[model samples]
Target: MGKVGPPITGLPVMPSDLPLDEVPEDVLREVLEEEKRIYRNRSYKKKPYPTSRDVMEAVREALRVSTRIHPDEFPDVVLHILESKGFEVRHVTVKRIWRAYETLVRKGVIRDELGVMM
Candidate 1:
């Protein structure tokens, strides 16, 4: 009777001492395919900066309040309001947030309380 052992998965096992040039074509093809799959998936899943709608709403609110208070210093006013509200606001962050707010307003995705001319 044959000894029952671990099920064979049919995957090729590369010898540690085997040089890259000596690797079998099928095993090399499998490795390349896996790498390509990983690369494609990595790119698909990679998001450098994901926009947060909550933050966008907060920015719009800040804009509305700031427009009433001081229209010229929208970014600064937004920064102040967000900071006072316990949000970590930076000068650059305020700029980006305000830009996103304007984009949404232009697209009519969200309403502006005071309304934006452009």
Candidate 2:
């Protein structure tokens, strides 16, 4: 065998550098909270999606055209409609559409007569 290097040892390790199992729970929680705070402070480059009102309006229009479909199809149909209108449909957007649908139903903006909000 060729010459081997000496086994590694003797490095200064901070408390944060300790193995996860060795770190105290309180310290880990503090570190996690700090990381979250730092992340929230960072600026993001992507453009934000359309306002909730706009999304809700799109969902309403889509529902109008899909009146006979089952209620469970609402999110997927709305996503397709939004994408067809040149909006980027993300999972978040789909979730927002479902939430807006519920809000509209609670506010009486969409009615069961129209087969839209039920």
lDDT agreement of model 1 with the native: 0.61
Model 2 local distance difference test score: 0.71
Q: How well is each residue in 1-118 modelled by candidate 1, as lDDT tens digits?
A: 3333444786554454345676699999999999999998876442123236646666777755654644456667655655566655543475586677777778887666545455
All candidates: TM-score: 0.39, 0.50
Which 10-residue window of candidate 2 scores lowest in summed lDDT? 1-10
- Backbone collisions counted per model: 0, 0
Kindly report which residue stretches of model 2 are placed more than 4 angstroms away from their true locations once superposed. Answer: 1-48, 113-118
TM-score of 2: 0.50
Clashing pairs in 2: none
Best by the TM-score measure: 2
lDDT of 2 by residue, 1-118 (tens): 2333444575554545445575588988999999999999896675446678768888788778887777677778877777777665664455677788878878888865335543
Candidate closest to the true structure, highest lDDT: 2
Question: Which stretches of candidate 1 lie above 4 Å from their native place?
Answer: 1-51, 67-71, 110-118
lDDT of each: 0.61, 0.71
